[model samples]
Target: MPLTGYTIPRSPTGRSSLVPYPPWHYVGDFLVVEYWADPDKAVTVLPNGLDPHPDAGRCALVFADWQSCSDAGGELLDPSRSQYKECFVVVNALLDGEEVTTCPFIWVDRDFALTRGWLQGFPKKLGSIWVTRTFGLDSPADPGVRAGARFGATCAAYERRVAEATVTLERISETGPTHNDPPIVNVRHFARLEAGRHDEPAVHELARSRSRDRIVSPVWEGVATLSLYGAEHEEHDLLAPVRVGKGFRFTFGYTVDDQEIVKDIRS
Candidate 1:
């Protein structure tokens, strides 16, 4: 007899996993803004093994409208299963003596995205996200072809807004890659408390993951205006912007190749 297909079990139970595979595709619009925060306050929120970068209190706020598909080829056109929006506040941190970026806070609107992010160790929550842009329909020969865009997000819980940001971009200029920026890294931690567990949590684990490129194209440079509000969650307080940096937009895709489990914090 010949095999047709394999039946794999879902994780947290069986050996099969949705990650560590290919054909994950993502198309989205991103509005990324860099800012400065208090180093002391920033350090307090990072996970056990990560530290804030010393070269100023640098951070990035990202607003994205995402259409993502995984494990299924030619399925990108279907929005019913693979459409979501995200807002993330990431800070520059040092991991194992190397400078990297770590997301301390993030919010998304879709359940599938929420589960995927949680399984990958991202502290993701539910929120509303939106992005609007103005495009000029000028002739191809016209100097100004593409106009600017705006990005906004509201982190809400129980129908109440916890955090929000409104960002506007006036113009965009394409730019080359700069080597000064650090690589993006993430710290994942998960735990569960069982009924019989008394001394500590029943399960505690920590891991690290990063994006493996499909491609990064069309880096743009521009000016932006940002207003951030963090009233509902104290964690949002660390994202207060002291100085705003240039705005940039780019498109990139990658596969979730693998992650390394660095520590097991179950005591």
Candidate 2:
């Protein structure tokens, strides 16, 4: 889907966000994510590793999104489900109006018919995931060539050749022959993430209730409103209300009006 809206990252300095975003591409047929950082912000990836991505330094917020690299890439999303929209919404929430470049992405099933399967990763790679941006290929080849690399005895050399080659792919259309060329999907990175507290706990009451099964409950003191999180759920149509009536009053369960006491726990 085309990105229709743009929101400025809510940075006090009006610069970047509290966090930095990193580079990640999907690998399922067309679910691959291939992206780069701004020239100044990006770090060149060495060829020693099979996977390549930029390093997000110390920052509070991180950017994230999924992309479709092939024609079938769009099928994995059930936008009708809450999770899909929530995924983007969550990424946005974490960013808090920070600029995050999420390339439009896609996903396809394991065997969507193409005359070629990426051969370098085949048999073992087939039915698995393959990124459109070849790790070493000068350009991504057709399914035939990618799948053809499977028959060589010097498999390691074949892999290194494929990895070093510049990436290529067909157009990410729903139904079109694999194009001879593919675009370098560029997702913008803004911040680096240092894992820390998203939320914290304030202990209100850590009371012990003695029962055969050991039912221990704690009261949590939250901001402004004291909210409770852990409580037993009753299954049989649990709809009950606080009952009040004449000659009755609401107070602590065991109490005489206007008197409060803190009993010794030793009892």
TM-score winner: 1
Clashes of each: 0, 36
Give each model a TM-score. Answer: 0.76, 0.14
Error of 1 at 81 (Å): 0.8
lDDT of 2 by residue, 1-267 (tens): 332211234354532321112111121111111222232222221111111222221011111121222223333363221011000000100112222221111111232111111111111121111222223445435222231221110001122211111112222223221110111112221222445622321211111111122121121111110101111321101111112111100011111111111122221
lDDT of 1 by residue, 1-267 (tens): 432222223554432543324445676766677777777777777766676677547887777777776666434565666778888887788877888777778888887677677666778888777655434456443223134544455556546565555544454445522212576555554444566655565444556665565676566656655555655553676668778777766655666646677666564
Candidate 1: Cα lDDT at 80? 60
RMSD of candidates 1 onward, in order: 5.2, 29.3
Off by over 4 Å in 2: 1-28, 31-36, 39-54, 57-142, 145-267
